[model samples]
Target: MARPPRFDTDQLLDAAVRLAAEGGPAAVTMAAVAQAVGAPSGSVYHRFSGRTTLLAEVWLRTVERFQEGYFAALTDASPPSGGAGGPGPDPARAAARAAARHVVVWSRAHRDEATLLLYGAQDFGRAEWSEEHIRRADSGNARVFASIGGLAADLGAADERGRDRVVLALIDLPLSLVRRHLRAGEPLPPHAEDLAEECTAALLR
Candidate 1:
C-alpha cells in the first residue's frame, strides 16, 4: 500500500503564504517552501507537482478563505425566508454594512494572502486544467458580485451596473490604499477604518 501523506498540507500552505507575503509570489519556490517547512524538497514535489501548481493552490486557498468570511457575514445578517435572504431594511441593511466593513478588516488582516489572490492568475499549460480553473474563477466571482450587488440594490443603489461599480470601488479602493501604505512604509492611517465605513455608506446610499 502507498504510504499516507506525512506532512500537513495546511501547515505547508501556511509557510508558503508567509513566504509569499514577505517576498511576493516569486519567493514561493519549491525549495523555499520546503526550507520554510523543514521538509525535504522531494516532499514539496510530493505535495504539489511544481511551483506553478503550488502557487495556484495558494491563491485558491486564500480566495476560499476570504469568500467564506464574506458569505458568512452576508448570510448572518440576511432576513429569513427572503430571496437568498436579499438585503432589506433594518437588520439586513445593517448586515450588508457589516459585510462591507468586514471586507476591509479581512483584507487588512490577511494582507499577504489578499494581495496574492488579487494578483495571481492561474497558468494552465495543461489545457483542461486551465479551462476548468478559468471557468470556476469566473463563475465564483460572478456569484460573489451578484450577491453584493443584490444587497446594494436592496439598500437603494441605482441599479445592477451602479451597484457593481460601487462594489468594485469599495473593494478595490481599500486594497489600493493598503498597497500605498505598504509602499510608503507608513502605518495604516488612524482614520482608515472610519474612512472605509464612510465610503461604503456613501456608495450604498
Candidate 2:
C-alpha cells in the first residue's frame, strides 16, 4: 500500500478550530489552517473545496460532536423506577438537569469547540454552505428541538409558552452561564455544573 498522506481531514479541521478559537471564523482561511497544521495549502484544498466548504465542515463537525452527547443526556434514559421501595426521583427532572449540566461540563472539556458554538452558523458562512451541509445543520437542530419538545410534554407543558420554558431551562439557561464565563476569557468555575443543574431543576419544577 502507498504511504498515508501526512495530514488528514481531521487534522486540518482541528487546526481550523484552534484558529477560530484564537480569532474568529474569519481567521480560518485555507492558508491559515494549512499554516497552523504545518501542511501545504494543497493539503487543505485537497480536503475542502474552498473557504466556504471548510467553514461549513468545521462548524458542522463541532456541532455534531456536541449534540452527540447533548442528545444522549437529554433523552437517552428511562425514568428510574423507585427501587421496590418507593417513588424515585423524577426522570424528566433528572434528564433536564443532566442536559443543563452538560452544557457547562462539555464547554469546560471542549473549550475550543465551545468557542465555535458561541457564534451562529451565519457567522461561519452558512449562507454559502453547500446543500448537504445545510441539511446536516438543520437536521441536527430539528432532532434536538424534537427532543426538547418531548421533554416539555413530559413536564406537563400544555402550550407554546410551556415549551419555551423547557427550551429556556434546557438550552438558553445553561448556554447563558457558559457564555458569560467563556466571553470573559475565564475558565468555568467548578460550581458551573452544579449551578446549571440546579437552575434547570428549578425551572422544570
Clash counts for the predictions, in order: 0, 0
Per-candidate Cα lDDT values, in order, are: 0.66, 0.88
Model 1, position 85: C-alpha lDDT score: 25
> For model 1, how does the per-residue alpha-carbon lDDT over 1-205 read when each residue is reduced to its tens digit?
9887777788789888888777777788889999998889998888888876777677767777887777776656643232222344665465555666666677678766755554545432223345555576566677677777666665667866776756654576555656676655465676665565556555555
What is the C-alpha RMSD, rounded to one decimal, of candidate 1? Answer: 5.4
Task: Score every model by TM-score.
Answer: 0.76, 0.94
**Cα deviation of 186 in candidate 2 (Å)?**
0.3
| Residue 91 error, candidate 1, Å | 4.5
The number of clashing residue pairs in model 1 is 0
